[model samples]
Target: MLKKLTQSETLAEQAYREIKQAIIEGRFSPGEHLPEEAIASMLGISRTPLKKAIEKLSYEGLVDLRSGKIARVAEYTPNDIENFLQLRVLLEPFNVEQIVRIPISEEKMSELVELVEEQKKAIEDNDLYQFIQLDAEFHLSLAKLNPNQKLQQFIEQLNNNLHRRYLILSKTLEYGSKTAYEEHVSILKALQKGNPEEAGRAMKTHIQNVENRIRGYQASSLH
Candidate 1:
């Protein structure tokens, strides 16, 4: 349920958070037009703040905006998602390979363990929003560990692009959250062993499985 906006940094920033959450949680479906007037009313704000929020979202690749036309949620075609996943298949494995070279500290390793455990709880509780967020946390956490800033930026971009799709698809594929959690565990285990080869392979498999799940769902829906 959307809450009424409370005074914070700025109305626009708060609206952005509210609207972005709605989009990611599937309340605002992809390609759906954002009726500025209605949303402004809902949040108890005027159109100015809402438009600023939309512009911010559009910049983040979460929303699509045109100069004169109405704003709409960003829609990723199959190819768009595939391209994102393919790059991830390359960069993320390399990310873990680098991580293994650093020999992640016991404390750092424990944090990763805790993160995945939180994911498990998110699954058991059927907390879709939290589950999706934690899924991003896992990847982004690993990406940050590497010293490569450019690589981190690239991975975050891909992660942001796929984030919405993951949210949408998870509702249709009820098993995905649990499956992704298990895959994370596999990657973590490989990392724990300090085996670069094994960790990279695990990462490659996890991402490929994501590709397959999305494609499988698309294929079945065609019938």
Candidate 2:
């Protein structure tokens, strides 16, 4: 019984991760109904475990589960985007400072470099989705170096929304990805130097650049 229960819990966690990834990747669009039966069929899991997974997503603000309605992907308005970016500007630089205060292993730094290389290839190939995934991974990996589980979890949650916005922006703006790649390079270089203050400043500047781009996008869209 104990083994079976553990296996079931593991399956539920797996289902949660897969479903969350699908939502972040825009497989399930904002406000789209998530039918339990269909998702279970697609994932080859039973509704019980899938329901548990959906509930977990709801807690993370990725899914909306009302009392009498099917779960839907959470939608963000322009105002929501602005608010999220503002929060990111506050939290992310602090995360960088915390991360760089500790010594980063050579292996971890090399992994980040590999991610950047993958991102460059994705950009060359015009694979926007792959680039976006790597972009999030790059920053989140830095945050993970801080050794604070709660802070890392909070940053991951923010990245989920940021990833969605990045996909939308990438489709609409021609130069956004190129600019972001440049900023990532700057941040990585600062980290490699093992300068905590420089890394934190680089992170702040990178996020501010993102904010500027989003504001510019919004301004142009209004015209």
RMSD of each: 2.4, 6.2
User: How high is the CA lDDT of each candidate model?
Assistant: 0.83, 0.76
Residue 21 lDDT in candidate 2: 62
lDDT (10s digit) by residue, model 2, range 1-223: 0112235457789788777666655567778889888888777768999899998878766788999898988766667766777888888888887777688889999999999889888889987657767888887898788789988888887886554554443232234888888888988888889887898888899888886887787687679
Q: What is the Å distance of residue 159 in model 2 from its true position?
A: 2.5
Model 1 agreement with the true structure over 89-167: per-residue lDDT tens digits: 9999999999899979899899999999999998899887678778888899998888889999888877765654544
Error of 1 at 144 (Å): 1.0
Candidate 2 regions off by >4 Å? 1-29, 34-62, 160-175
- TM-score result, candidate 1: 0.88
Each candidate structure's TM-score, on Cα atoms with residue i matched to residue i, is 0.88, 0.70
Error of 1 at 220 (Å): 3.2
